[model samples]
Target: MVIFGGAGDLARRKLFPALYSLHRNQLIDQRFSVLGVGRSERSADEYREIVRDSINRYARVDVEDEEEWSSFVEKFDFVSLDVKTPAGYQRLREAVEERERRYTIPGNRLFYLAVAPELFGPVAARLKEGGLTESDGWKRLLIEKPFGRDYPSAEDLQAQIAGSFKEEEIYRIDHYLGKEMVQNIEVIRFANTLFENMWNNRYISNVQITASETVGVEDRASYYDRAGALRDMVQNHILQILMMVAMEPPSRLKPEAIHDEKVKVLRSLRRWRGDDVKRYMVRGQYTGGYLQEKEVPAYRDEENVPADSDNETFVAGKLYIDNFRWSGVPFYIRTGKRMEEKATEVVIQFKDVPKNLYFNKTNDLGPNLLVIKINPEEGLSLQINAKKPGTDNEVVPIVMDFCNNCQEESPEAYESLIHDALEGDRTFFTRWDEVSLAWKFVDPIRQAWDQEGADTLTFYEAGSNGPKEADALLIQDGFRWHSPYNPRTGSVVHGSPIGD
Candidate 1:
């Protein structure tokens, strides 16, 4: 494994920790080695110590065995390589070759780009020029997100990477798809007879997917300001989850077959332009307010953010998939930083029964709902109506819950993603066409925001459930956002039930 940004935060906080856990579990082979490329000058022993500290600090599992730690560190090698010039690439090549020969292992190489997006093309070109991809064994390139800001930029990056590697050789990582519950979307829909039969417009009324964060962007202000909520969250994570919920079941569970189904969802999205952008999308920036009983600064007041910046920290939109399965159903997506609670969930609100036989007119029983909890917890629950105990012909909301948080610990998303990439399982990774189509669907909205909707930046208090206009986006359609503000309560709080 060759990591381009070996000393960066992601390498220390996530990448190295996941690798250490993999090694601790004996999943990584003894013949496998890692060559870290960066501009820092450090001895192999020094780099090993850095990795040791990182593992101790961030690894989910214990790395306390002295002999095991020593064995793991022996595989670590570092080379100082300035990506700007070709000379450093030659040195990197030598380091990899030496490790391959010393370990007596076949030259199966996995090059991971954990650096900024701007350097993706330059590094790939240099790797090719230095003969890194000409190995006798299989070679794969694993790239991190920010896969271009929009459609054109993504295509340009794709062309540049395609110059050195084939489509099969590339793996674009979206760690959310690696979550256990997200992977279960296929199982819940396909494996279960009850859900598979009703997973369409007929039985489903609206689907709401929410990924809200309680913490503000502290160090990531610069990047977040430019990317905003739409490009940062909607274009990748939210849309990927949407596909998992809306896609047709694949003929077989192969990578290509899954990709085909997901791509179809993207292509089926109703294109929004002109007034549709304003009508269907709501953008907002956070203002200074309380979060978790403590006050926090607004988005504009954060470091590196312009005082008058209209960059959106929150996005809520209604997407309609113009297909037979989901023709009139709306897929509502909402994401933000510095919101009420840290949660990632999907709510499938089934249509209500026509006849209210058990409840009075004023106390109308709600529709049945299926909630898939993804983060801060992992589980599924179904909402049903039941007779109120000791009451005469009264129906009340009741829940059937499956709590995934009962376990002590679950594997991090990065762990699964890295493992799949090593084993050549592309089921959870996004393909080129999927990325392109997502960008195509997202570009017009972004362009409209830049041109006319910039002033549409409404302000919501920190730690709140976004601006009220988000509620209106759904209220107009006779629906509402499903708020899991307190997942521990096991209650699905609709937007109307919670007032400011």
Candidate 2:
């Protein structure tokens, strides 16, 4: 494994720690080696210390044992590279060869780009031009998101990498897909006959997938300013989740077959144009307010952000697929930062029953709900009408919960993704087709925002759900977002099953 930008925040914060966890779990063998490449002027021993400190601090598992520390650090090494020059690539090649020979490792190589997005294409091109990619064993490239700023840029980046490696050699990482619960979407659907039959427009009313965060852009002001919520969240992570929830079941569980089904979902996405774009998509920026009971500044007030910046910290949209199974069904997605508790979840609202047998209930008997919680807490729950605790036989909503992460700690997203990459599993990685189609769906909305300007860029309190317009987007359709905050309680609300 050769990690570019080894001393960067992502490398120190996520990559190294995940690698350490993988080692601790014995998922990786001693014959494997990792080479950290960066411009930092540090010796191999010094770099090893850096890695040791990182693992000690950020590793998911305890790695304080002297023997274990020594054994793990022995396979760790570093190389200093300017990244732009041929000399840097040559030096990287030497370090990789030396480490492979030392550990009797195979020619197999995994290149991870944990550097800035701008460096992704150049680094991959340099590796190929430097002959580092022409190994006797398989060579794979695992890249981080922000694949491009927009559709054109994403296509260009794809073309640049295509020159060096084939489509199969690239692994596009969306860490959300690696979440234990997210991966279980397939298992929960296909493995169960009940869900398989109801997983369509007939039984399901609407699907909502939200990934909200409580922290504003602190250090990523430069990137976030340009990317905003659309490119940053909706384009990759949120859309991928949508596909997982709405895609057709694969004939088999193989990677290619699964990808094909997912691509079909993307292709079937209903495209909006002209006035419909503004009607369906909404954006917002956070205002100074409290979060976690502490005060914080607004998005515009954040350092390095322009006072009048129109970049959206919040995004909510109504997405539809024109496929036979999902036709007329709406997929509502909302994601933002500094608005609410950190939660990632998928809520499937089943259509209401034909007739009501009970009367005088505390609240309206709502549609059945299947909630798949993805983070902060990991679980699955189904809400159904049940007999109230009285003899009158009134109906009330009750929940049956399956807490997936309650008994044991699930592996971090990076841990699972890294392991899959090493095992050469494309089932968990996004292909180029998915990427291009997602960009296709997102580009027009971005262009519309650009051309029409930010006159509609609304504001919401930092600690609240989002701008009121986000809620209006749902109300306009005669439906509402299933509150992901506390689905177990009576706070969950349902609206008309057939949307306006």
Candidate 3:
């Protein structure tokens, strides 16, 4: 493995920790090793110590055995070089060759580009020029997110990288696809008779996919201000989750088959333009407020952000898949920073019964929901109507829940993705067409926002759910966002009852 940004925060916080956990679990072979490439000046021994510190601090499993720790870190080597210049590629190549010889390992290469998006093309080009891409074994390239600012840029990046790697050899990593519950979506649909029969517009009412964060842009103002919520979250992570939830079952459980189904979902999305953009999308920025009783700055007040910036911190929108299976079903997606709780969940709200047998006594009954919890907690909860234990006819919503990670911790997203890349499995990675289609669907919204500026942008309190217009986006359709889970009560507080 060759990590491009060896000394950066992503390397320290995620990459090293994931690699250490993989090593600790004995998932990788003994011949496996890492060659970290960066511009930071550090010897191999010094880099090893840095990795040791990162593993001790951030790894899921602790370092309990001194001998094992020593053996694992010994295989790591570092080379300091300017990634932009071709002169440093020779040194990097030499270091890689020397490590393969020392470990008596085959020349399989996995180059991880963890640097800025601007460097992705330059680094790949340099590697090709230096003859480091050719090897005795298979080679792969793992690219980090924000593939491009938009469709054109992403297309250009693909063209540039095509010089060094083929489409089959490239892995576009989206961590959300590796989540436990997200992966379970396929199983819950295909493996279960109950769900598979009703996973369509006939039995399902609406699907809400949310990826919210209780955080403001802390140190990423430069990036966040430019990317905003739409480009940052919606274009990649949220859309990927939507694909998993709504895709048709593949003919076979192969990477190509899965990709084919997912791309169809993207292709079926209804294109929004002109007045539809305003009617279907709601964008907002956050203002100063208390979060968990502690005061926090607004998006504009954050460091490096312009005072009058129109970049959206929150976005809520309705999407339609103009296909037979999901013709009239609405897929609502919303994501933002510094709002409410930190959760990534998909709520599959099933249609109400044809006859209201219990409505006369109970006034209203909650919609049956199959909620898939993805982050902060991994679980599944099904909400159903039941009579109160002591009452004859009083009906209430009750939950049957299954917690996925209550017993033991699940593997981190990076861990699963890295392992798959090493084993040459592209099951969870996004293909080029998927990325391009997502950008095509998202580009019009961005262009509209740029044209209208702050006229279309709204503001919400930092700790609040989001702009009222967001709720109105659904209320206008006679639907509402599902009430979030209440930690103290261990139940989902019911929102407005679904209208007939």
**By lDDT, who's the top model here?**
3
Every candidate's lDDT: 0.88, 0.87, 0.90
Q: Give lDDT tens digits, candidate 3, residues 87-131.
A: 999988898888889888788999999999999999999999998
Rank order (by lDDT, best first): 3, 1, 2
Best by TM-score: 3
Rank candidates, TM-score, best first.
3, 1, 2
Candidate 1 lDDT by residue in tens digits, 45-97:
89998898898899998777899888888999899989879998888888889
Worst 10 residues of 2 by lDDT: 491-500
RMSD, each candidate, Å? 2.0, 2.1, 1.3
Candidate 3 similarity to native, TM-score? 0.98
Q: Which residue runs of candidate 1 sit more than 4 Å off their true CA positions?
A: 360-363, 485-487, 490-500
Error of 1 at 237 (Å): 0.5
Better of 1 and 2 by TM-score: 1
Write down the TM-score for model 2.
0.96
